[model samples]
Target: MSAPANYPIESVENAARVLLMLRDRRDLRVADVAVELGIARSSAHRMLTTLQSQGLLQQKPTRVYAAGPQLVQIGVAVIGATDLRAVARPTLERLRRHLGETVHLIILDGSTIVFLDGVEGTFAIRAAERTGDRAPAHPSAAGKVLLASLTREQLRERYPSSRLRGGTTAAKKSRRMLEDELEIVRSQGHAVNLGESEIGLHALAVPVRDSAGNARAAISVSGPSVRLTEDKLTEHVPVLLQAADQLGASLS
Candidate 1:
């Protein structure tokens, strides 16, 4: 095999080196970073300040720096996404085969639902490709299932006001209405979207909970409303629930 070509950019390489140094040491100082990188103190200070601003580094009360909350979040997200995709693909494929509808694995990121992976159905017409796309939480079945997992205080913090955007006429536009819907979702152990996130799309979702019963993700099946009627959706609920349970157990 040919050796990989090296394209080293000086500033980026130095910043990466600094980050690696901080990985083994906490409460780092700019002078320490400078000494380790063999760079000027002023340059080290500038790099540290930039990283701190972006939440990669945090300055302590004692004037030392450590990894910030954003960095921790990024790390967790990376690990979780990798593991989830690997573990959930078989279940997602099985659901698609059983239901003949698009299957999706999703997780909530802040106020939005992110599609981590998906399997297209056998039908010619199917739900839109959702992998790597983010949609507002209020209008998606997967979003509601995931949102219902949060505590009341967390819900309050996430949606403080009643005014919210609607993706379609079926979508909840007010926080009060959304909260009421989420209460039903929690009680029913699932959520439904009938032309809410997109016109003519119907979706049903159930949470994949960990050992502690906290929802870590959601698995959903979606298709055109013409074929995915309320009766069909209700009929498919047990299948989705079973797959979700199996996947959750494996994850736990």
Candidate 2:
């Protein structure tokens, strides 16, 4: 006997796949998606049209379909306050208490670094710019760690082709100059924000890995930039790493 018909789960799943492909590829024509998914050209057209009507996708002047601006807004809304906030809150507080400095939990969701959680340190002078404020992913310590985890192709796909926007010199980000930073983070096992994201701020970030060894987020300590130098980093970096390891171990 055949099972009863239900929601078009297969179609819905395919739609999700198509949405992700559009997100990664950006500016894809119908044929490009059809070839990628191995679906008939007609089926691809229908899917694209359906998604476009729902504001999940858009067809541009070049007739290329991409993730709609509305889709990005929806994604930002859902992803802004994620479950990581709940999972990492106490960890962040404990980490701040141990270091006596501010701790921030940052996650790389798409091209943005989402501030998921944080514990403020009681240093009369501390790194308390804002909570839940997002910065573009390049100069931020958390962004560098996340970039180190991606393959070259994946990196290119996520960022615009021409520009690299790491930030400013005090923050060290410009469009198209991030390769060196990623290399350093990969080799050093962590990333540093040397007043790069902000003039007087210093941050060191360690990767927070899940059971799959994928960096789900980063744990970082941000303090006065004046005191955070290469030599001092030697002492403080380990504390950040240990905190990350404990978080990772709990995930296991």
Candidate 3:
């Protein structure tokens, strides 16, 4: 027998309802599902058992059903897709408007930093838009901020060689030096690049953290060194931090 195309399957609808209810609360009980879906307790129990078998829900010792591993994995993937660039674009644009400097959303990829999106500054002599560009992770402010989130073991894995290679003389020359710089970045909760990527180019970055307080990405503002002096960069930290928090909250 063929099912009607326009009609919703009762079992699927009930299962979706249970999932939605779980979203609003920490867990769900069969009795609660029964009442919410206007179904019998036995029917609710069967539905929950099926969902649990499918790994969408787990039955706890307390007799409650909570999100299972598969559901959690799906939620994490959705957050990743939502956080990448589109979700951060508005924050990037607002930061550029406020600071009048080029703003970039970036992520660390192995030993490289990939620019996911960027907004050009209003000034004529400003950092160029770096969307789709990749650079060594040890030099750029955003790269440093993201790297600071990793453990020492992870850092060593990414940079096995003691000597760090970069485009310019200002870049960190040794892995030990880079590690020390990352420690400072972790302590200060931000990062700075003063002509490390290129002479006379300055940048500042703050991390956009996830629900676990780990950096999922970084937001950076870049401009000429003369305009973004050390003092000016320090002054801009508050604004960048606020924007980073906003982006992080959106993902959460």
Candidate 4:
């Protein structure tokens, strides 16, 4: 037996296609959209203009269009509504237990990292609950792991200026510095924060990649710098990588 045929509204489908294209391409010109959709330039312009008017897209000075703030808001809402935290909690708990340090699941939002969930360690003094808190990306292990997943073009689009919002004396202060750090993150498949986000705190993070190999989120273990020593960080990296792999598999 065959399934019944379904109907899709042409304009709505076209708009959704445009959105998907923008997601993969990062930015688009009307001509690019036209070629992708096999639509006339005028029709593509009309669609893009409508999307821009509705705040789903924005045009840059270069005349290329990218996702607008409204789309990002919608994405955040969708991510919030998803069961990603629930899906990741088991692995997070396991890592926390094994490391005896707080384990966190974080996602990137623009140039910042938002803590979605966390598992506290058994230590009398450890990193506190950071769930729902936001922090600058360049200063956190989770943030650097997430940022390392982006292409250079995407990074430039996100940070057009060289100067970055300072988080601490240890934080990367410029795009050049961040790019250099990100290269290390990419090569190592993880990142470490040495009191960059907060004084006397230390963290190590690994990216939880999706099936497409994009860093959908990051898993991190954090504690007081005194106990989470350089040797401890070296010891914890393989364990973190294992947990991240399990979490990514589950997510996929």
Please provide TM-scores, in order, for all candidate models, with all chains considered together: 0.70, 0.65, 0.68, 0.69
Model 1, range 94-114, lDDT digits (tens) per residue? 998888899999999878787
Quantify all predictions' global Cα lDDT against the true fold: 0.84, 0.75, 0.87, 0.85
Give the C-alpha miss distance for residue 213 in model 1, angstroms.
1.0
For candidate 2, lDDT tens digit of each residue in 65-94? Answer: 766646755654687534556677788888
Model 3's TM-score against the true structure = 0.68
| Clash number by candidate, in order | 0, 10, 0, 0
- In model 4, which range of ten residues has the least summed lDDT? 1-10
- In angstroms, the error of model 2 at 234 is 2.4
- In model 4, what is the error at residue 35, expressed in angstroms? 54
For candidate 4, the TM-score is 0.69
Question: lDDT of candidate 1 vs native?
Answer: 0.84
| Candidate with better TM-score, 2 vs 4 | 4
Clashes in model 4: which pairs?
Answer: none
Give the per-residue lDDT digits (tens) of candidate 4, residues 72-146: 556657777247777898898888778888999999988878777788999999998666456788899999999
Best by TM-score: 1
Model 4 per-residue lDDT at 10? 82
Give me the runs in candidate 2 sitting further than 4 Å from their true place.
1-77, 171-176
